[model samples]
Target: MSSQFTVEKTQHPKTKPDQQNLGFGKHFTDHMFLMNYTAGEGWHDARIVPYAPLSLDPAAMVFHYGQAVFEGLKAYKTEGGRVLLFRPDQNLERLNISNERLSIPQIDEALVLEGIKELVRTDADWIPTAEGTSLYIRPFIIATDAALGVHPSPQYLLIVILSPVGAYYPEGLKPVKINVESEYVRAVRGGTGVAKTAGNYAASLRAQEEAEKQGYAQVLWLDGVEKKYIEEVGSMNVFFKINGEVVTPALNGSILSGVTRRSIIQILQDKEIPVVERRISIEELYEASVNGTLEEAFGTGTAAVISPIGELNWEDKQITINKGEIGQVSQELYDTLTGIQNGKVKDTFGWTFEV
Candidate 1:
């Protein structure tokens, strides 16, 4: 039950880069939002075209069976020009739990949140009011049948792009380092690692390009059957803080349930601050960093909403946390979740959604 949509606008409009060097997802946003799906006529034509290039049919079953599913959210503007959207209905209920773990069909989370509020109100001037900048939405799905050996994929598409960003780790809040890998792994218990598919990040790009050639800014995944618990950190969702509480890692079906990791565990349980999920061991976070309580370490999603894990290399041993600094509860949970996502904090947990 979803139809009505169209908007063509954009007779070429490019030049928009330099919100003090945007970074993160390079650039993009001139209008985009598509929708198709065809198995006895289901999700029809919806459009908002003009952001080009996407011919797909080189035997497109997501280019040979990797079905695909995606999501990531953001779009804050509010210096008064209003454009909020932080919990986009929890990213379309986690993209239909990654399209039912990649079998791929189902998606109408209220017609994709009204096609993400009319494509962010028709690209609301491409968002970005500087400060830390944002407007990176994404939302994807693909499995376009066009002949492939894959068993599913009757045909599908679903786009939704827009990008305009900054700091998805070039060390914006500093503190990163990580690398506790212990020989790859990342996802077990019936796999597809809690489903944000696309071959679970194409199987972690050869251990994040060998932990970025030894400089380390990613790779903390452990537990594809006891590589000794831990789970994720580079693609976000880690968190430590031992003794004074706050621990994370317990959505086990192999992690990846992060809408900024449940809004940093509901803002550390609404500031009572004892947050605890369960099972977290790299020898219990290196014995709480050798009995100093381990203090603070962080990582959450929607692209670095709170990175902060200042050093931890393992197996050859190295540690450092809080002293490598960024704590104070990861700068007050990134200033109260970027101040309740750019409205300068006062959504009172309704979790924003203006557009």
Candidate 2:
């Protein structure tokens, strides 16, 4: 795993964006890290080069077979001039899981982590300093084989890029309206849903677009088989506070295992709050709303630490959560998570990795 990395600085550096209006994934830093994987050579030629368009063969396997995987995390610049990463190890572990599922060669976890740290340090100035702003890190692998056969690619390319991003949603922490999607299913049991691959997201674009058209922020996906049980939100894991108990869907191989979701569960358990991970049906959620037991709802992910779900529209029926405002539980969780990330509060869970 010990490999020498060559660094090449960009000749024409771009101007940094305004921190206040730094939208997500719109702009990338000057340099990116890349490594290649071949059948017998394994992974080699690790280097940091100027960010630019990639020249790939048109017959690359990724275009046809969709053998690719990616992971998203962030680097934060604290008020005290310190840089930090939140639960990066977990993200890499999950990336390997995705690689295994996609039949892509496994990455050296430690080496890749070192590459990420080096890349972040190399572009330290790119980390945003404004409130709710951070450097979004995207690490991905793609099959680069030229042949069109339906087998695993013998070649691959791993790339890590950095983007200075603002809030994931333009509304920031404001509560959002979600539409329960019953028509199109995102994933099914024994499928690629659990993997953070391109195909899974490609399958969701239609549903997400329809949800957006209906004046909703995101789609609340249901299980594919029954279309009755709740799975996850379009881009995050969902949680509902029902009758003082917080419930989220159990990991049943069809939902992405989110790092933020795991952290929130741990945080709740540490505080001794009633948290349960089990299958919850959409009908049960609607019934809880009718009985006035659905206290609050929120979605957890890396992009939006916690997105408070204020309203849900399901089959022409609308249910308002917490009077269409941010609830106390959601607020506390958001504050604690963001505070730990930005160095405003003590990180008791040892989740922050200081770079």
Q: Which has the greatest TM-score? A: 2
Q: Candidate 2 on 227-275: residue-level lDDT in tens?
A: 9999999879999999999999999999999999999999899888899
**Model 2 vs. true fold: TM:** 0.98
Candidate 1 lDDT tens digits, 1-355: 1246878878988878888779888898888888999999988887888899999879888887888888889988888888888988988998898898788788888877887789888878878797878888888988888885758888898998989897565446888788888887867878788888878888888998999899997899988776888988867888888888988989878898888888889988988999989898898788888888999998888867998888889979998888888889888998899888988878788989886
Residue 343, candidate 2: Cα error in Å is: 1.1
Best by lDDT: 2
In model 2, which runs have C-alpha deviations exceeding 4 angstroms? 1-3, 169-171
RMSD of candidate 1 to the true fold?
A: 16.0
Candidate 1 whole-model C-alpha lDDT, 0 to 1: 0.85
